[model samples]
Target: MRDRHLYLLLLPGLLLILLFRYAPMYGIVIAFQEYNIFKGIMGSEWVGFAQFARLFRSPDFYEIMRNTVLISLYKLAASFSLPIILSLLLNELKHLVFKRVTQSVIYLPHFVSWVIFSGILISFLNPIDGLFNAILANFGSTPIDFLGSSAYFRSILVISDIYKEVGWGTIIYLAAIAGVNADLYEAARIDGANKGRQMWHVTLPAIRPVIIILVILSLANILEAGFQQVFLLYSPLVYDVGDIIDTYVYRVGIQEANYSYATAAGLFKSVVAMTLIITVNKLVKMSGQDGLW
Candidate 1:
């Protein structure tokens, strides 16, 4: 009876995953078919990799793929270590009030919608009468079009994304740090280890498993540059540098009504992401660390 109640508590979450996540996976069949709204899944003509071939042959394929990979990799390389660093720095703070206030200020941006955040970025980066240009003018520099320039778009995307999510990312690392045994720190102190040495030897090692798991999970989505943020921020002028896979799919699949082609691209991303996750997990296991498996 006790176990039955426990199972009952699991029902709602399981049902939600089945309904929203697993059930929608069936629609992937459209990737292999010439899907029509009226003809439906059962009636659609089977195409069998035609869409994939067309996607690969498309003129814009390499450019879109390049933009997607570069932006994702840049964000990962730049932002991934920041949260760990922030968590460690914050963990060392002795003043409770200051720590809480600092954390709250940093975390506030995470809850803001990308639509609003993008608008704020646009306003700040505007060439005329914008905050950035106003400051640049003071230094005797000409007003630069940050948003319209392809050269600046990727940098802006990375910086803005890091600003919004870095604090929220720190929460997980901070929690992991909090769970480290107090005795470990005491032992380090007794061994004449200073703050830096203690952090390097004790705290970092304690949180290594959490870091590995998060890194492995992030690898699964290595191709997913944020769709909402990119769509909101990018324009035709910056498409060469700012366009990503999700935004490309939205433009081609949803806007242009090339459903099968878009589906093929999406399916490709999913397969690659899954492969990355599995490979990374295997590598982690070989290195004698805990993995998602």
Candidate 2:
């Protein structure tokens, strides 16, 4: 009877998973079929990799794949480093009130909708009379079309993503840092270690496990570049640099109504992501560390 309460508590969550997540897995079958909404799943003809073949033959496939992987890699590297750097910098702040205030300000952007953020970014980066361009004018430089230009689009995407997510990322690291033993720091100080030395030797080592876990989990999401950010910021002109798989899927599948093609593309991303997660987890285990089980 004591176990009854735990089962009851878990029942709701389990039901939600079945409804929202597992139920959607059936839709993945559309990738292998000539999917038609009117004909439905059972009635649809089995195309047997026809859509995947079409996708591979498409002229844009290689470009989109290259852009997606490169953008995702850039975002991964920046996002991974930014949070750790923020947490470390914030940890060194001795003033509690100031630290809390700074954290709150930085984290506030994460709560804003990407739509609103995109609008704000467009206004700020506008080539004519925009604040950023205005500042550049002070240096006697021509205004840069940051959002529309292919050269600047990916960098802007990377930096903006880092800004919005970095603060929220710090929360996890901060929690890990908080759990570090103060006694270790005290001992380090007693041994004539400075603040930087103590942080390098003691605090970093204490939080290494948490860092490794987050890194492994992040590897699983290597295919997921920020969809909303990319969709909003990118124009046809910048498509070379800004086109990622998720955005490309939306454009081809949802906008163009190429359902089977979209499904195939999405399935490709999922398979790649799953393989990466499994490979990375194995690597971590080989290095004598725990990873996703």
Candidate 3:
């Protein structure tokens, strides 16, 4: 049967999935264990929900959770809408050469490491002699250290993340737009629909499914503010707003060697993420569209 060949074609990927993905899932037992280096994972004593209890009791837990959710929410708002906006703007460009060049330049930042990007941002946002501060100084305003200030750190994080990813995100929308029938646009134009109205009536409706799917996926990652960006850019002073669950886990688990506590924290985040994905998927389906299922 044709299906047999298709299964054969997928065999390698299936094997890889079992080996790399499912195999590592066994380590989740550490979340319920009093993990110790000498005792090892299997030898460690079981503690059930004790670690989770301690994690919840920690004073910093609420702060970290708030930071994670708030930052992720900001990113969700900015990231979800930016690509759609960019795709619409790009679609309006009739010049292929200019469009391609602009896309290439914007997508270029995505390939740059967060460490490198953070350094660039620090330099640009420096209080003294920085581009932003220099411009402010010219207008008789005092210099402000954007990166050092807690009030501005989250803003910087969201803006930088948007700048890095929005172009790459637009590629999918652009592809969806390409699949939309050109005849719809022609018909709308003949019916007295302007460019904006044509987009509202035709192009957007056509790509609504893709937008819905991506938004659902984005909500699923509502806890995952970019780890590398935060780790690279944040200092002790700005940790109030910049510290995320991932960074907290890294510091506690890897740096401080509190494996059991870190595992508990990580497991909590995973559970929440899974719950969000499932809930959003159901909502999307109920709204009458294809979903992640």
Which stretch of 10 consecutive residues in model 2 shows the poorest summed lDDT? 208-217
Candidate 3: segments with Cα more than 4 A from true spot: 1-9
TM-score of each: 0.98, 0.96, 0.95
What lDDT does candidate 2 reach at residue 179? 91
Candidate 1 local accuracy as lDDT? 0.93
Give the clash total for candidate 1. Answer: 0
Ranking by lDDT: 1, 3, 2
| lDDT score at residue 38, model 2, on the 0-100 scale | 94
Candidate 3: tens digits of C-alpha lDDT, residues 1-293: 86999999999999999999999888899989999889898799999999999999989999999999999999999888889989999999989999999999988998998889889988899898789999999999999988889989999999999998988899999999999999999999999999899889999999999998898888878889889999988989898999999999999877999888888888898899889989999988998899987
Q: Write the per-residue lDDT of candidate 1 for residues 1-293, one digit (tens) a residue.
A: 86999999999999999999999899999999988878998999999999899889988889999999998888887667999999999999999999999999999999999999999999999999889999999999999999999889999999999999999999999999999999999999999999999999999999999999999888888999989999999999998898888998899887988888889999999999999999999999999998998
As a whole number from 0 to 100, the lDDT of residue 116 in candidate 1 is: 96
The digit string of per-residue lDDT tens for model 2 on 1-293 reads: 87999999999999999999899999999999988889998999999989989988988889888888888889888878889888999999999999999999999999999999999999999999789999999999999998989878988988898888889999999999999989999999999999889879998889888888888888888888889899998999988877888888899888988788899999988898889989988999899887877
In order, the Cα lDDT scores of the candidates are: 0.93, 0.89, 0.91
> How well does candidate 1 match the true structure, expressed as C-alpha RMSD?
1.0
Clashes of 3: 0
> Pick by TM-score: which candidate is best?
1
User: What's the ranking of the predictions by TM-score, best on top?
Assistant: 1, 2, 3
